[model samples]
Target: MDKEKVEQLKIQMQQWLNEAEEFINHIPPVQLYTAVGVVLFTLILLLIIRLFKRTTSNTIILTGLSGSGKTYLFYQLRDGSAHQGTVTSMEPNEDSFILHSEKDKKGKLKLVHIVDVPGHSRLRPKLDEFLPQAAGVVFVVDSVEFLPNFRPASEYLYEILTKASVVKKKVPVLLLCNKVDKVTAHTAEFIRKQLEKEIDKLRTSRTAVSDADISNEYTLGVPGEPFAFSQCHNSIIIAEASGLTGEISQLEKFIRENVKP
Candidate 1:
C-alpha cells in the first residue's frame, strides 16, 4: 500500500510539473523576461548582502594585565574550556571562528575574529595593531586580586581609553571583571568605582606632566570633574565573568551586541 502511494505521488508530481511548464510557456515573452530579470536581480542583491556581511568588522580585542585571566577568557570564548594553568601567553592568541557558545548554530552565524593581545608590558604594544579595527574591546580584570594590580591595570586602561585610535573610532569598551567564581572576588560596581578613582588621579598627573610624557594625543575624561567612565566619548560597560567555571554569558553578550552574527 505504501509503495503504491509513493508511485502515485511521484506521478502526480510529474503531472503538476508538466502543467507548470505548459503554463509558463503560455506566458507572454516580455512578462517572462521581466520575471527572470526580477529573480536575477534578487539573487544579485542577496549575494551583495552576503559579501558585505563577510567583510564587516568582526574583531573583538581582549587585553588586560598578565594575571587578569584574559588569556583564559580567550580560551573560554574560542573553545568553551579554560585549559587550566595557562601561563601568561607570550604572543597574541588570535583566531577567526564562530564563537564557542554559538557552535551548535552551524552555518547560520558570522565568524568572529578575536585578537587576545598578550597583557605583558612588552607585548601590550601589539594591541595597537588590532585596536583600530576592533568592533569592541574586552579589558579583563582580576577581581579577586584587584587591589594589588589596580595601579598598573588602571594605567593600562587609561592609556587605552585615551589612545587616538580608540577615542577617534569610539570603540565600545567592556570592563570585564574576571575570576568572579571566587568567593573573594570584588563586585563589578566596586571595581568600577576603584578604577574610576585611579583613572581620575592618573588624568590629573598626566595633565601636570609634559604633554610628551603623557603622549597627550587626546585628553581623557572631563577637564574639571573626576574621571567617570560616563565622561568618556565611547560607551563603557562593566560586567563580571568566571573563565574557569565558564560563566561568561555577559562577556559573550557584549561581543554579540557589538559584532553582529
Candidate 2:
C-alpha cells in the first residue's frame, strides 16, 4: 500500500512539472529569456557578495616608534606571553592566528592578521602597504618614556592620520600607551593631550609649505581650531597596556572590536 501511494505521488509530481514546462513554453521568448536572465543575474550577484564578505580584510596593524614595544605586543597577542629580550624589529613581523587570549573561549574565533610594521624612518614606507587593508591601526607609545619620544611619536602618528588610505577609509585608530607597568609611566590622558598639541604644531608648519612640497595626502584637523584626534576623519581612542607584563586587555578589546570573533 505504501509503494502504491509513493507511485501515485511520483506521477502527480511529474504532472505538475509537465504543466510548469507547458506554461513556460507558452510564454513569449523575450519574456522567458528576461525571466531566466533575471534569476541568473540574481544568483551571480549573491555569489559575488558572499565572496566579497569572505575576503574582507581582518588585518590589524601595530605601528609606532622603534622602541615602542610593538614587536613585544605582537608576540604577546599571538602567544599570550611576553617574549623576553624582544628587540626593535628591523622588518615587519606578521602572522595570522586566533588571538591567544581567545584560545580557551568556547566556539569559533576568526583569524586575526597582525602586522607589526617597523617604525624606523626608512622602513616607514612599508606601513602604506598594509594601511589600505587595515581593520584598525594601533599606535603604540612608550608611556614610560613618553616625554623623551613625544615629538617623534606625535610626528609618526600625524603621518598615519593624514594618509590617503587612512582618511578615505576612515580607519579607526587606538592610541595605545605601552609600558604602563612602570611607576613613572604617563597617563593615557596626558599622552593624548600632548600628542594633540604636537600634531597641531605639525599641521600649521606643513600647511604653510607649498602643496608640491607636502607629502601627507590629507590635512588633519579643522583649519581654525586646534588639532585633536577627534578632528580627524577616523575614529581615534586612547588605551593603556603593558606588553612586558602581558596586561593587554585594552589592546585585545580593540582588536576584537575591529575584527569580530
Candidate 3:
C-alpha cells in the first residue's frame, strides 16, 4: 500500500510538470507573435503618417523678370481674373489662397503660398534668401522681348538654377513664354524653338565659364548646370497671359503633374 501511494504521488508530480512545461512552451510563441504584431502595427502607422505629411504639403514659387505677369498670375490664382497686371515687392504675404478645380472637389488643395520676388537686378540678394524654399519655379519670359531680353533672362535663369541646384536640386522649373497673343506671327513651337536656341547658347556660355582657367577672375566655385536637360525635355507651356485662353488651367496642370510637396 505504501509503494502504491508513492507511485501515485510520483505520477501526479510528473503530470503537473508536464502541464507546466506545456504552458511554458505555449507562452513564447504567443508573446513573440504579439511583439511582432505590435512592431508591424507601429511601422505601418509610421509609414501612413509619413505619407500623409508628404501628400499634404505643397508650395510653389513664382519668379521671373518684372512685368512678366508674376503678380498677375498671383491675382488670377486668387480671383481667377487677370484684367490688369499687379506688382508687389519681395515682401512676405501670409495670405492663404484657395486653388479650386472641378477635379479636386475634396478641397485637398489648400493654401498656395505664392512668393513674388522682385525681378530687378537689385533684388537678387533677396531672391537668394527666398528661392531655396521653392518646391518648383515658374519663369515667365516676355515673348515679345525674347530677342533683346533673352540674354538677361537666360542669365537670371542660370543664377536661379545654380542656387536652386545646390539647395533644391529636384525642383521642376516651368519656362512660360508669355505674351504669345501679342505675336500672332510666331507659333508656340516657333517660340519654344527660339527659347531652346537661347538656352543652348547659355549652355555654351556656362561650359566656357566652367572650362576657363580663370585664376585671375574672381572665382565663385563651379556653377551648377542652369537647367536639367531631363526637366526641359518635358513640354514647355506657352501661354498668353494678356488674354486668358486657358492659360491658368495649363499652369495648374503643370503644377499638379510636376510639383509634389
For candidate 2, write residues 91-144 as lDDT tens digits.
889999999989998998999999999989999999999998898999999998
The stretch of ten residues in a row with the least summed lDDT in candidate 2 is 82-91
Q: How much is 178 displaced in model 3, in angstroms?
A: 2.3
Model 1 segments more than 4 A misplaced? 1-55, 213-216
For candidate 1, the lDDT comes to: 0.90
Higher-lDDT candidate of 2 and 3: 2
Candidate numbers sorted by TM-score from highest down: 2, 1, 3
Who wins the lDDT comparison? 2
Model 3 poorest 10 in a row by lDDT: 214-223
Q: Give lDDT for model 3.
A: 0.60
Query: Which tens-of-lDDT digit does each residue in 1-261 have in candidate 1?
Result: 699999999999999999999999999999999999999999999999997764468999999999889878888998999994278888888899888989988567878889988889988889989987898999999999999999999999999998888888789999999999999999999999999999999888877777677673578787788889999999999999999999999999999988887
The sequence of per-residue lDDT tens digits that candidate 3 reaches over residues 1-261 is: 699999999999999999999977778787968988999999999999997765443566667776666766765665666645454546532344665443346635446666666677777577666555555667777766666676787677656554524223455667776666674424546655565556656655655664344322222222464433334422334544442433566667666664432
- Stretch of 10 with least lDDT, candidate 1: 209-218
Using all chains and alpha carbons, the TM-scores for the candidates as numbered come to 0.77, 0.83, 0.63
lDDT of 1 at 155: 95
